[model samples]
Every structure is written in structure tokens, then in C-alpha cells.
Target: MRIEKEYRIFEDIEEVRIFNATKKDFYKPTPKEFDVEDMPFQELLNNVSTEIHSFIPYENGKDFIIQRLGTFTLNKYNSKPKDAMGRRLSKISPLFFDILHEYFLEVYESHTPKKIRFVYYNGKKLTKLSTAKIVFDMDRIFVVTNNVDTATNRRVDADYRTFDEDKTNMMENFSQTGSYYKVHGKYVWSQGVYNIINRAKEDSDDFYNIVFDLVIPEDQHIVDKIFYLTNNETSQCGEVIRIRTANGVMKVIEVNIYSYFDDSGIIIRQGLINDITQRSDYGLSKPVDFLMDGFKNSKKLALLIEPLSKKQYEFSKGFYYMIEKDYGDYNHSRKIMKNIVEKDVVKNLNKLINGELDKIDEVLTFKVDGNSNNKKIVELYIERFNYNNEVHSLGFLTDVTEDIEKQDKLVASNEQKVVLIKEIHHRVKNNLQVLNSFLNLEKRAYKNDPDLIIEHMQTRLTSLALLHEKTYGTKDFVNINLKDYLVDHDMKTEGFMELPSQVEFETIVDEDLNLSIEVITPLLLIIDELTMNAIKHAFPDNTATDNKITKQITKLNEGDARLIIKDNGVGIPDSKSISKNLGCEIIKSLTSQLGGKISLIECEKGTAYELIFPIRMDHTIN
Candidate 1:
């Protein structure tokens, strides 16, 4: 048999790094391939060790250091190790350690020994306690610090854990501050710290508190510096703060801090910063508050300059609220600002703000020159009020000087377009009228049987002409207010007979919904045809006329409308002439084109024809 040769990607020696050798292969090892599942567990352990080592940088291991010292390991589970115990050198599985162990591993080197310790407490003693092994993952260590309180009282004795009104209110305020000092020892963190401190106190452990003092740590003190430098102590971490000065203006300060670094290294801390003054009773005195207040009180507009009275200016800087409104309406913002300003003022300052009022809605730059920061802030809002237990929207104005200028240019262009549109409608209407005149001339030329021929032709021409009239009268050239125009036409027509003067013919339509000009034409012709037929046939002789009639035009929704013509008269007789009337035939045909349903009912009092049609009013603006 020929000698077999096995091919491998790496040299035999290199392949050995990945594959393990069997007992007999130590001298002349047989080739073996490595698979994902077959990879040595020791390799996985080494890789984890390398990752942990790389993550914990030299300068940012403060939190991790404190954590690892505090945590318990399988090798060192008892009290502090005075000497290096042989057990300390034993191997530890990553699973045996807690989340803090992995967290520490992510930040620190695997081979590095953990240093520092932290004991958590919920009371004067470390009772009912558990400990974590601070590994490279222990950057989230529970360290001992008293400068800022982080206690939650949820763990207090069950019987005494009932809801507390004052504490609840304080909790809310504390929440606003982002982090608050839990004055009482009822909080869990406080209990933890108290327990840890007492334990240390019992054992004379003064090393922890002595390391950190009342003063902020140098590395984690950026916030303290910004607040102290700006002297804006009103800022609280993790919350929105409003600062209002003596005047009625306001300033809003939002502070957020997500990281802290101490002697050992960097740590993560997340919280909001808010100014309590913004929420206090005197917020109206802030500067922004005053301006917003003035804007709201003014009829047309309002204008405000920066650097108002210190108190008012502070209020202005601190004021903050959300403005909401319906689609296409700007009034929501104005209303929100107005409500905030007016609610806090005793006297209206309209007189002083009168001249400036007209420009309130106008866009302008609000510049504060005293501070190094100088920029214009733009705002827009609308007027609103709550009436009859409901909120009603009023018009809104905006500081859109640039936007307004552009809009003005656009409007100018649109105006030119409007003129052209009007001209087109006018020309179309005139042409339709001229055609009507031509029909009249034709009638004169064809004098024989003129009544029958002219009537049919006139109805057709009028149907076309009605569209022009509707187009010219409507603000939107595409949609027509057919009901109003038709009712007007009925009033204007000279030959139409009238019912009791008090009886009214009305149209109930949704003003917001628009309808196409095409639909209106067929609808009008159908109405005219029915009305004329009814007038002529319903009361054949005027001497026998003792009936009332009224028409109702109602739109069901955006896509459909109904027309009802009811009268008190003799019902239709069972004759083909009644159904075969030319007008009736034309009505049915036209109704088909409109995608509508027609019903003719002979009620005991009279006859009623209800016409329903589908319509789409394209009113969405680009």
C-alpha cells in the first residue's frame, strides 16, 4: 500500500497549539484537528483572563479596587487575610463569582490581585447580609461614602413601612433633586451604610470615611466646579431645574452627570439635575416668565428683552413646560406659555408692554450680552383657554422672521397663482353663459316645437353652467359648497313656487369636508329635474294645490352625501308615464355616472326621492 499523506493548514508544531495530544503521541504525535466544541477549556480560561486584564486601565480602577477588596472569594471567604494563604492561590471559576465579579473582570486584569474593600449595611449592624467577590468586574462596587445620600426606605421594618405623607412628599422633592439626603435612618442605603459604619466602629475601622471627606473628590468634581463657578447651585443632577429671579422671567437649567472618578479610577453615576426655584411659588418673577406672561396678555402680540430684573430674569431662565395642539395649529405653545405667566401675576403689565405687544408674535433674537454666551432663541405659541370644562384652541403666533419672510414670498407667488385661477374660472363661467345664450338663439331659430326642444337643451346647458358658478364662488377652486349655492339659487329663481314662509329648507354639511365640483353639477341637475317635475305634476291645477315641500341636503361623511326632497301631495299613480318621464330617465342615468343610489318612495302624504352619492374632497395640504 502507498504511504498516505495528511494535509493541514499549519505546520505540525503550530497545529499542536490548538489540538491536544493523546498519551502515546507525546514522542511522535498523530495529527488531530480542532473544532469549536473540542477547543481546550484552559484556552477559554486564558482568553477570559486576557480580556479582564485589558479592560481595567491603570488610571480608572478606583471603583473596581474598592469592590474586589469587599467581595468574598472561594479562596478567601473569611475575615481579611493577614498573610497570603495557600487557598488564595487556588483556581476560581467565573460562574462561582457574582455579577460584580464579571463586572470587575471587564475592568481589571485577570492576574492582578484585588485591593480595597467595602461593606454595605442597612442598620447599625451588618446583619442579614450578603457579600460579592470584587473581581475585574467590581467597578460597580458598593463603596462607603456619606457626602451624598443614596438611601431607599423600602426595606424598613414591615409594620413601620406604611405610607408616609411627609416622607412621600420629601421623596418627590428628593427625586426632583436627582439625589437627596435621606435624613432619617429608615432608608435601605442609609441602613446599609449605618450597618457598615457601626461594624467598622465596633472594630475601630476608621480607614474608610477618613479617605473621603465632605469635600467632593477632585476627579469626580466637574459638576461641583461648574455649579460653583456659574454659582448655579439650583442645578440638581438627574432632574429638570427652573431658576426664577425676583422679576417675572425664568431660566431653565438641565444638568446631567453620568460618570465619576475617584482616587483609584473612573466609575459610572447617572442622575438628573433640576433647579428647585423653577418649581417654587415665586417662579412668575423670573424674566422669561415675565416675557411669556406679557406675550399672553397682549391682544395682537408681545415682545420681551433679555436681562430683565434679576428675579424675573431668573424665572425666565428657569421656566419650562410642554405645549400641545391639534394638527396645523400653533396656538398650543402660546397657550402653555400664557397660562404659566398669567397665573402668577397680580397686576397686568399690558400698558408697559402695549407698544411691544404687536411684535410679540414676530420672530426676533433674544440676546443676553452680559454673559459670554450670546445667541438668539426663537419661540412660537398660540392662545388658548379652558372653557366649560374643555380646552379650546385659539390662533398661535411664532417668531419666524426668516420663516415669515420666506412665507411672504411664497404667499406672493401663491397670490399670483390665485389671480390666474380666478381669471380661469371667470372665463369658464362667461363661456358657459355664452353657450346658454346660443341655446336661446337656437330656440328662436327653431320656432316650431320650440318649447319641447328648448326645455331639453336648456336643462343640459344649465347642468354644465352650474359647475362654473360653484368653482368661482368657492375659496378652493376644486371643491364647491353646493348646498349653499343651490339654496341661494332657489331663493333667486323667479318662477319657483313657495310653501309656508315659516317652513325652512336647510342643508346640514360638515364644513371641514370638501366635495368635488364634478359631483355638484350632476347633483344640481337631478335636484332641478325632480323639483320641476314635482311642481308641474304634483299639483296639476293651482286651484287644488294644498301641499308643502322642503328639501334637505346632508353630507353623511367625507365620502358620501344624501339629498332628500319631501312634499305633501297626491302619490304617484300606477302609470308608465310617471316612470317614463324624460327627467326621470335622465336622473337615473346621471345617478349611475355619479356612483350613487336613488330611491323614490310614495309616502301617504306625498312622494320622496332620496339620492346618495360617493364623493372625495381632496383637502390635504402639501
Candidate 2:
């Protein structure tokens, strides 16, 4: 007969494809070759001993076996010999038989699949199988993966996290520094002493300066003596020493060591060191008044770099507060450097740690999430210091978003105030100069006539005061509103100024036009002098027989504005006389100050005075 085998896998267990594959030579091919029901119980027991796996057996079930293949057998590899009680040895033990019986019962009762390497057929050979081996029609079962922290090494408890913020981390970071020699320590053959000590030195040799003022004795003999005394009980097992961090804070450490012969037959010592700086027995916990002295009140997260490991940093709580994060070390490293964006910053940070840079006090602006375009500025401050003999960089990062914004606003406000103050000063100076000129003119020409002098001074003072008012009254002091100023006052000079109501005064102002106080103040005063000159001298006798008079006003060009005051009474004298008059001299001086030019034109009606000046169109009114 041909043989075929298959493993049909399933949940819980696998199935055997062949229910009863027989190697027996039966009396009839389709009839029972083994007559279990017909055979006597004793004969079945005898058959079990003869061919152990020919019949199915169960625990405490010798009565229920196929009658002819009665007695139970055991798996030879796991079977135990009978003891001194005179019991005989069996191929299968009672306990395993019980297990087998229960397993078979479960299969028979529930039709569940079970993989069993049972002796197959009368040939009594074991065959591999799975729960799915049987050709049974059943619905497919769904399988799901379970997520949990599982350790394949069941008895091992170590997954060292050097940043657990507890004693476990402290122990791992400052673990015993040397290994037990296999021959000397009996069972500790895991790590060699030399390898352990060398790695310890590589990790910490640079940090051992003066070490708490209890420096390790340099003399070889003294060190040996101390070790021997410690082992012999003449000295304590540990020596207390201080170790300073690069940040300059000193911490206490306890060192213990044992000497032994290694596999190389060389004498070696293994050491265990403990940092006891914060322990209560060390008295560093502090008095009541100092208990909470240096604790931070700010919400910023703090992390310490000393005695930290890459794995610990990957799982750090401080990193959790950042907007971006990944679950592994490679991702952490990629983004930590990648997010910086500025290559120079990374270069300088390396230099800072290497003691090549003076300091790292800079604002690092980057996206909150590594890949985002939104940026934030953080003040990264790092300082280098030496502890023991090792160099370390201590860094502090602070978000300066609010602070920078407030600083910018304050600077803008102060700048505006300064401009306002300067404008006020300019206005004061202009009015004072106008007052000086008015007083000079009155004292020189109208001194003999008190009434005339007072009258002229009052009118001049009013104009000067009105100009000051216009400059101060509006919030914008840099530029004077020309349109408003034109109509602001009535030009009310009581004795010296009177124009016919029929003599219409008209003005044109560009919507976008204004003049700086520096230019406008002098120009306005000059306009006052010229207007009085035209009214007083140009129309001397009101002699025009016509019923109406008119004055022409105009603008000269795009940047230049013109003021023309013309009348119909009379014409001006010769240029020589006008230039020689004190009023003309004042007008000329004021024009010069205003960066303007004044012209007197002879017209058919009378005289026309023209004042042309530059105007600042930037500061405009609608």
C-alpha cells in the first residue's frame, strides 16, 4: 500500500489525516484484524506488553482499552523504572496515560483537532500531525495578533531602561564594574574580568579627578594593600569618594571591589560602584528650610544628561511633551538632527560639546513638528564645564515666543513717542522764531506809536498763535493739513486787514496734499505778510469804478503749489522800493526760510503777489 502524509494547521491544535492506518496482516481486508472486544482482559494485557501501541490506551483506563491490546505502554524516553515496592516497569507511566486518556476523550467529545506523534498502525511508528490534518468540513477561524510586552526568555526580567527615574536606573548606570573569574567564582563565567574592567575604564576614566578629595591612591602597593585589607575584614568593603559632574555639582559614590585569579591565571579585581549622593544617610537631603529651595516653578520640562543612555532618551518623558515624536531610537535620532534645518547650528552644537565653541546661547527657530512649516523660536543655552576630568555641556531650552513679540511692540511704541516729541519741539521752535520776527518788526517801525505797535503786535501774535494751535491741535505734528489750515481761521486782522465782501477769495487743495511743519510754518507767515501787502498797498484808494474785484489763486506744477493774491485798487511801486521796505525784507527772509520764492507782478487791475513752495503729498488728507 502506498503511504501519504500531510499537516493541515489550525488554531489550538493540528489533526492526524489517517484515523487508523494499520500495518497488521488481517484475516480479511475489510474485517477486523485485531479483535479487541472478543479478546479476554488478560490476553489484551499480554498483547499490550507485546505490541505496546497496537491499541489505544488511557490513564487509569486498563479496563477500557481495545480488549486484545489491553495493557498501557509508556513513551520510552520519559518512562521511569519501578521502585523497591516490587512494582514492575511499564512502557508508559500512569500519569502520562491519564493525560493521554483525557486528551483522547476531549478529541472524541468535541471533534477538536489535536496533534499527536502516536505509534502509527500495528507497525508502532510515530507520525507527525496537526489539528487540520483530518479532512473535516469546518468553518475557518480568525486569528489576531495580541499586543503586549512579551519576553521570550521567560525567566529573564531585564529590559534595562536607564531613565526610569528610580533605583533600577541608578543601579544599571552605575553597575558593578568588573566580572567574576569563571574558575575562581565557580559559576559566573559569563564575562571576562579584563573585558569588564576595560569597558568600565572606557566609560568613566575621564571622570575620576580628585573624586571627592579622596582620590584613589596612585601607589600600586597601597591599592593592593587596601584590596587585601577589605577582603580580610581589616578595612570596610567600600570607600566613599566624591565625583563631580561636568556641571560642577559633586556627588558621592561608594566603591567596592574583590580580587581573584582569572582564566589567564592573572590576578584581577572586579568592582561595584554606587552613587549615594541623594541618599538620606549621606545627609544631602537638606534641612527643612532648604527642602524645596531650587525646585522649578515654571512649566518647562527638564531633563538631565548625566548618566543617561540612548535607550532612555528614546523613551524620555521630556520628549513626549514635544509636538513630534516616534517610538524608536533611530527615528528619534533622525528627527532630532533633521528638524534643526540649520546645518551650522548642528556644527556649532558639536563644537560646543567639544569645548571648541565659547558658548551656545542662540535662538533656534524650527517647526514644532519636524516636517511642519510652522516655526517657533527657542532659546537654547548651553554652557561647558569640567567635572572630575571630563568635559560636559549643560543645556537649557526656553521658548521665547511671547518675549520676542512683546519686545517688538514696545520698540514700535517708543519710536512713535519719539517722533511725537520731536514734532512738538519743532512746533515750539517755529512759533518762537515767528514771535521774534514780529517783535523785531514792531519795535523797529512802530515804536513811536504805542497804539500802532500794540495793534501790529496783537495781529502778528494772533497769526503766530493760530499757527502754533494748528500744529499742536492735530495728532499728526510732522505735516500740517494745508486744506484745513486754509479755512481754519478767518484771517481776522482787525485794523490792518479789510477786503470787500464782493472780493471773492477762493482756494484749491489737492486731495492728497499736506506740508511739513518745517516748510509750512515759514510759508504761512510769508503768506500773511504778502496778503497784508496786497490789501494795504495794491488797492490803495479803492479807486476802481467797477463794482467787483477778484483775486486769482493757482498751483504752479505737480510738486509746487502757488498762492496769488491780486486786487484792483492800485499797482505796486518800483521793485527797488518794494525790496527796500521792511515788510518786503521780512517776506524775503520768510520766503528764504520756507525754501520758496515770491514774485510781484504788475497787472492791468492792480498788483499780483505770487508765493510758490514745495508741498509733501505723502502725508495727505482725503
Candidate 3:
């Protein structure tokens, strides 16, 4: 069995009438006068049978047409709107035309025909409003005023119909600000809006001859979709979009729209488009991007640097303008750092980038060409980011004049304190030498004593004084190099032997080793006692031609130190009895002071002594 369908939608004095000829379905003979004002468009479209096509809202003064209503019409005939009518058989209504207007205009707001999901109920359970759907013609929704003549770059006028004043004044104004629809996405009635847009486009003839053509090709569908959103009844705000200018230049702008629907079903739209190219969040007013024009007024010069490239980068004249005084990578280093203070800052900066320094809050102050009054102090802050496989640093330079003045004053005070400290060290070293001289004078009185105790006392005082002599030789008064001390002490003690020219001395020190004066002093005195003992007993047969002394100091991988001394000499006749000697007791005390052990072993050709101790690195600051 085949089916035929037809619909009649007519309006009378009191209510609208809708009838389906095929099924003989009617919503009402007199759709009982319900106030259209109270009727939400959804409920009214719901009340009518889904077979009414061509919703013609006819009034005495105005003509309105609603097409593409197949879901409501249940029409089997799906054809295009008639190009030239042959005759009126329920007036040439088709599925596409009737349902397009039904779902988009009547069922919802003025939008391009799209498949919208709507819940409905004939009598019992809720279901989709229409199984039939209409494809969206996103192109046709925007007509006439949107037309752009490729040659002239001009907008064509959209035809309009005039109505009564007081009631339609808002509609007339809306038509001027925003192009609007009259017959729900079918026709536009914009007079003022098209005129203003055309005029604005004409005024900026050089760059954008067609201002009304500012609508971006891709954005047309979005604009249509936005106006049709369910709850967006009254207003829509701040829809930013990209638009083409007269010369096809892209610009960013913000648009706002307001919807006005009168009781007579007259729809109006009002909108505002503002160019935000120079907004703070955009290019012109930004910290980096604003440098084109804004930096000419700024007292400081901000640089855009690429450390990896280390070269000049051209600025876009229209977008970015480099200040003539600003330094690029090629010249910035030499230009910024002329004085010692600033040069030191550059050195430290390299250290920071090389991972040698960890401090970030660096400040440097310098005077330009000896002008003390023109001192400028800058507190630098840096941030790092990775770009193009290279780590880059962005730095902000801010003047800190007041803070630097305070720092300079404090630095001068610190310099005075440093001078005072250095003088004290000088005095301490000199006082120690003077005390050694006083002891030498006192030892003169005990010269006649047996075993020459006064002689040993004099040698010990001389060794202690040598420590101060070494301290005064270096800039750092606290820490001393063990290797340098060993070399110097060996040279000084060579002349103590009766035949010093015949004896050969050799010293071997580890690659990197340093010790404090406190540790070296006890060891120096121990070496002195051993050297004196070697001179008295080592070559007892008066054989200086075969005499040789060797000293070795090494730092082990396990953080311990070893000292070895060997001399070609007659071994101790009574090594046990030597423990009773005052010199032996002193050596043991000195070894204990260093927290080490001393061993005496007679080798094949000489006597050998080995000292082992922990290499404590706790003492750093003087």
C-alpha cells in the first residue's frame, strides 16, 4: 500500500488552524484561543500535529512564511521549493523547505537548518520530535549583505520592508547594528546595520574596502550556531574571532550580540564588534611585544636575547621595533660592562651558566666614565626555558640605585674590617718570630748542659718559627700547601749537616694536598728532631760521600695521609733505649697530636720511618 500526504496551516481571527488531509488529523478545529505570549514556542509547536506544513503567520500589515517542516508535516513528497509554480495544491510545500523553517525557526531560534534533538510526546512516552531530518545549509543562512564582490571588495545591500514606528523602532535599530532575519533564516531586513557596515568598510578603503565582508569564511557557521543556542535568549557576549580586513589582513576582534523578539514575531538582533589588536592581553600592550613603540618611552632598555645564536635578529617594523640604544648579543657584553664591578658580574654570570655558581639574585653597580654621581645599580633576575633544543635565559634588569648606595657604604666598612684583620695576622706572625728569638737567647744559658739539651730546644724553636715564615709568604694566612712547605723546609734544613754539600735530599709529594698550620707545625717539629738525630748518628763513621735522605707524603684514596722518611745511615744500636730519649718522647707526642702512628724500621741500606694519619677536611674557614 502506498501513502499520500498533504497539510493545511491557516490563521483565523481567534486561533490558528492546522489539518492533515491524508490521515484526516487535526490538532483543533479552533485550537482554543491560547495566549501566544504565555506559549513558549516549544509548547506551541508541540501542541500542533506533526503533519502541518508551510506555517504561514499572516497578519494584516506583515507577511511571514515558515518552510521545511516535514517532521510536523509527515510529507512523503521531498522536493525543492518550486521555481515557478504550476498550480496551488495545498500551495507547493515540500519536506526540506517546510521542515527547515519548522525545526530552526519555529522549534528553535533563527539558525541554519540542523538536526536538533528535541523530546516530545503524542500521548504517552516521550520520543524524538521528528524522525525526518533536514541537512543544514550553513551557506544560505548568511545572504545579501554578506556577499563580497571579488573585484570591488564591496557589500551588496539586502532588501528591507518597512513597518510601523513605535513598536518596530527597536527592530529597525537592531537591523542597523546586526544583520537580522525576517522569515527565520530565509530573508534579512537589515537597513541600518548594512549601511553602517558598508560605510565603515568604505571609509577604510585602502586597507579594507569591504568592512561588511569582515566575516571570516569559517566563522559564518559559528555565528549562525551561536545565535541558535537554547538558553542564549537575551544576550551573548565577548565572542572573539579573527576577521579579514579590507586588504585581506587578519585582525582579532571581540563581538557581542543581543536578541529582541517582539510579540508580533518580529525578530531583531543587536551586536557590537570591537577591534582588540592593541589590547594589553594582545600584542601592543604586552611586556615583550609592546616594545615596538612602548620602549621608546621606557627609561630602561629591554633586550630579547638568544644565547645560542649570539647574533642579531631582525624585528618586524610594523610589529616590533628595536631601540637604537639597545644592545644585541654582538655588542651587549662590552657595552654593559666597562668597569671592574660590572666585569665581575659578567664573569660570575658565565660561572652561573656553566653550573659553577648557584646564586641567582645578583646585583652590580658601576659609574659611567668616572662619574660617581651617575652610579647605576642593577638587580638582575633570570628565567630559563628550552627552545629549539637549546637552553636559553631571559633576564630582567632593574635599577636599584638606593640599594646600591647602601651596599657601597657597607662594602667600604667591610674593606676597613679586612685591613684590620690582615694587620692582626701580620702582628701574630711577627710576635711568634720574636718569641722564638727570645727562646734562642734563653737557650744560650743552657748551652753547657750534657747531651746538648739547649741545642735541641733551639732547633725546635727554629722549626716553629719556620711555620710563621711560611704563613707570611702566602696571601691566605690560614691554609698552607704541604708540597711547597716540604720543598722549602728541606732546602732550609740542608745546611744543618756537617757535610751538607755531600748529602743529597729528595722529596716526593702527592698531586693535590694542603694542610693547616696547626697540623703542619707538629709534623715540622717531628721532622726537625729526626733530621738532627740523623746528623748526629746516621753517618757515625764520617762517610758524607754516601749520605742521602728521602721524604715522601701521599694522600690515599680512602681519605688518609701517609708520610715516609728514609736516610742511608747506621741503624739505631739500641732502638728500644732510644724510646727513653727526650727527642723520642717529643716525636711520640707530636705523632699523637696528629692522631697518627709512627713506625721505625731499619731497612737494607737505611733507617726508615712511616707516619699514617687521617686526612680530616673539617677545618676550612680560618
Candidate number with greatest lDDT? 3
Candidate 1: deviation at residue 109, Å?
A: 87
- How does model 3 score by TM-score? 0.35
Q: How many residue pairs clash per model?
A: 84, 12, 15
Ranking by TM-score: 2, 3, 1
Tens digit of lDDT per residue, candidate 2, span 369-426? 6756766566666555542123433445565656787898899768867776776777
Tens digits of lDDT, candidate 1, 275-298: 344456645321122224444433
Write one digit per residue (lDDT tens) for candidate 3, span 228-323.
Answer: 441243334347665664444455555665455546644434344445544525463211223334434444443333321244222222111222
Better of 1 and 3 by TM-score: 3
Instruction: For each candidate, give its TM-score against the true structure.
Output: 0.31, 0.40, 0.35
Better of 2 and 3 by TM-score: 2
Scored against the true structure, residue 444 in model 1 reaches a CA lDDT of 67
Over the full model, what C-alpha lDDT does candidate 2 score relative to the true structure? Answer: 0.45
Q: What TM-score does candidate 2 reach?
A: 0.40
